[model samples]
Target: MHQCAKEEKVRVIACGAIAREIIAICKANRLGHIDLQCLPAIWHAYPEKITPGVENAIAEARAEGIERIFVGYADCGTGGLLDALCAREGVQRIEGPHCYSFFAGNAAFAENDDDVTSFFLTDFLARQFAAFVIEPLGLDRHPQLKPMYFGNYRKLVYLSQLEDENLKRKAKEAADYLGLEYEYRFTGYGDLTSALTRL
Candidate 1:
């Protein structure tokens, strides 16, 4: 994807925990090297704030003449960080609404389908739900079994998961907060499955 982006004259710089993975994928496809770096701890914790270490990552990439940067990890994990870094460095950052969803369009991902649920089979998607869905819903709705609607269902993926004891607590809290419909299903990665299944 980066290569395609670059071939189209898109300047590309990559940062994230999976920087190595991006590097491997790019190299395997003979994508030319730009600049790559593992995310710093500060970037992960308080993404809005870039410490000296985080600055170093940007500097290293810049030194390689990378004109633009794209943080390659899931949005939940790196979105905040990307936002902060872009603000702090005055450098542009490109990320998707969600990381898994972003890859669906990238040629680097070789799936026949752009189904979001397919990511649930990956630990990557599991982590994304834990942050984006589980956490926010917990703070808001308290995690009750409920139906969720997006943009009037223009494109939606629906799947259900049985709540674990812990998920039950969060679900109850989410129910009170978000007030969306929820149902008991047999899987844990509901958010990804739902959106992807619909696609």
Candidate 2:
């Protein structure tokens, strides 16, 4: 094992989707002692890839002489596997089922059972709606599949990380594309900041 310095900086292995926000938060809070490494954001669609990807990133960070490492991921549809890996690696991760839940405040999100029929999108997801949601889901090539995919989703909830009107418009447009009602909620990084601050 590569030994680290006495004052080694903290390393965060994160999801690419939240990388920008994490950097912004760290900068704003003057948490310059931390470093971030992100895995491909597209892996969000493939939960099976997330655990190994995170493990590899952690190993790389460790090899780079990082003594303290944190994972910036939620369960993210990995079905407890991410948590298991984190435990085995003796690392910590954000608390929630997914980014949307944490951004909404974990406790509050847990209490809001009514949102089960709603689909969610964050700033990154809103920006990459075409590539992430539409193209990968094949809704672009087969518009007819929209109803089948979103039939149970009565509303599209845009969980805004920043107060950007452009992202809001895009999220609304995404809602329209799926034929679902539009709702907006500004979460502003919620628990992510607090979690990072703890480290």
Listed in order, each prediction's TM-score against the native is 0.36, 0.95
Alpha carbon lDDT of each predicted model: 0.40, 0.89
Instruction: Note each model's CA RMSD in angstroms.
Output: 11.4, 3.2
Q: Write the per-residue lDDT of candidate 1 for residues 22-109, one digit (tens) a residue.
A: 5445454445533344554224434344334455666776776665554333344544655666678875443344433343333323
Cα distance off (Å), candidate 1, residue 13: 6.0
Q: How accurate is candidate 2 locally (lDDT)?
A: 0.89
Worst 10 residues of 2 by lDDT: 1-10
Superposed model 2: Cα runs more than 4 Å off: 1-7
Q: Measured by TM-score, how close is model 2 to the native structure?
A: 0.95
